[model samples]
Target: MERKVLEVINLKKHYKGNKAVDGISFHLNAGEIVGLTGPNGAGKTTTIKCILGLLRKTKGRILVDGMDSTKQESKYKLAYIPETPDIYPMLTVWEHLKFIALAYYIDNWQEYGSEILKRFDLWDKKDSLGRDLSKGMRQKLSICCALLHKPDVFLVDEPLVGLDPKAIRELKDAFKALRAEGKSLLISTHMLDTAEGLCDRIVVLKKGTLIMEGTIEDLRHKVNAGEDTSLEDLFLEVTEDEKE
Candidate 1:
């Protein structure tokens, strides 16, 4: 059996009386990419933050590589890219890579760092400080940092938000390569088409509850949608009650 990279069991988070995440559970297996999607206010971000230990969970268990996710050791095996890229303003593009390498204790990282810069078309901006880069460049830099250590699992939120067409294509290609190497990924995005094409399975949330989980075909079957039904339509049909 494939090793489970991450497992969330009966996870819950709440504020006052608002249940941001209400007893949701799922797992990402080695080499699998699972899409976590939901409408606005559906608890997607809360779920992710809980898993990352950014927010204290109201209840539940999160295991990363068979260890408690809140533990420091588990963090070493995980990487995250949020909707907005956060980088040190004084650090040059190249410095960011070096910083990551040192933090991850990567030996002989120079060649790999250089290759990553070139792959993302950021070689020419290597000396540019983070403050000098545009939104797209900043996003690219974030991607570079996240992948530099080659973590066992990746949790990306709105990864394509600021990427240009070329960067988008390159990032997608990189994700495919990571999967080929047996890394698990959990992608959270509002872009249904991208998720539909990239994910092995999808977990949907509505008002802090998991409404569905399955492949595109499996989802179509769950909703009684035709085989040709698009994910966008499926999502709409499943979450239509939210807007009512």
Candidate 2:
């Protein structure tokens, strides 16, 4: 049996009358990559934040590595890469990795950090301050910081947005490598092509609710699409009625 590394059960978050996340449930098993894709305002970020315990959920449960997400130990078991790269403006690239290591109490993180930095093409900018880096470089640094911890589960949001082609390839390779190491990944992305190729299963959300969850073939079956039907087309078919 596959071990479940992350689980969200009937999760919900509300702001007065606005329901940002509404009873969405999903699980990511060890070594699996699950893509969370949806239209804007479909509650992707909100759901991630809830799982990260950055936001208090109005209702439901979240488990990280089989422990309640609210537990302090659970925090150490998962790492998050947000849609926006939030870095310390005054801190240099290397300093960011150092901070993550210290925060996660990860010993011997230097070699691993250096390796990831080189892979992301940020080795030369190790001495550069965060504010001095371009959008893509900042994104790269954020990924390095998250990777330095070697967490069991990774929550990635918009991972390919600002990446150059080389960096994008490296990130994709890293994802596979991590999976081989038995790490679970929950990737929330708007890039259908990336999801189609990289994710083992796809979860689609609409208006803060889960509309579908399954493999690409399962999705095709759900929509009665042909074998050649792309994820983008399947996504459009499901969401087109929402615009009406």
Candidate 3:
């Protein structure tokens, strides 16, 4: 059996009257990419943050490589690239990489970091301060930082947003390469078409609840959709209900 790199069991996060992430469960295997997708306010981000331990979950458990996600060892095995890149305005593009290296205790990261920068088309902007880079550039820099540590699992939110065509292509290739290296990725995205091609499987959320989870073919079967039905169409069909 394939090893599970990440697992969320009966996960939930609730505010005073809001069920941001109702009971949901999913697991990501090593060398796999699972897309977490749905319309706005669907709890996609909440689920990810819960796994990252950024926001406390009101119920349920999270595991990283079979260890409690709150453990230091588990944290070291994870990396996250949020939808909105939160880079230090005072740090240069290259400085950000250096900081990650220091935090992760990665030795000889210069060569690898240089190659990553080149791959993402950020080598030329290495000296540019984070505040000076555009949204796209900042996003690229955030990816580079996340990659430098070579974590076992990656949580990427809206990864394709703010990226140019070439950057988008490069990021897609990088995702494939990471999978090849036995890394697991949980990608939260609204870009259904992109997710269809890239993800090994998908987990759909609605009103903080998991509505669907399966391979494309499996999802098609669940909805009785024909072979050519796109993920977008399938999503609309499953989430057509007005009431939660």
Per-candidate TM-score against the hidden true structure: 0.91, 0.90, 0.91
Per-residue lDDT tens digits of candidate 1, residues 1-244? Answer: 8889899999999899999899999999999999998777888888888888889999999999999997899998898888888888999999999999888888898898999899878999999999998877787788789888878998888788767888777678878877997988899987888899999999998889898899999999988999899999999998785568
Assess each prediction's global lDDT (C-alpha) against the native. Answer: 0.88, 0.89, 0.91
lDDT for model 3: 0.91
> Superposing all C-alpha atoms, what RMSD in Å does each candidate have to the true structure?
2.0, 2.1, 2.1
Tell me how far the alpha carbon of residue 149 in candidate 3 is from the true structure, in angstroms, after superposition. 2.1
Error of 3 at 30 (Å): 0.7
Please rank every candidate by TM-score, starting with the best: 1, 3, 2
Per-residue error for 45 in candidate 2, Å, reads: 0.4
**Ranking of candidates on lDDT, top first:** 3, 2, 1
lDDT of 1 at 57: 98
Off by over 4 Å in 1: 105-107, 241-244
- The model with the greater lDDT, 2 or 3, is 3
lDDT of 3 at 66: 96
lDDT tens string, model 2, 130-205?
A: 9998766777687788878668998999989877887678678878887887888999988889999999999999
- Cα displacement (angstroms), candidate 1, residue 158, comes to 1.3
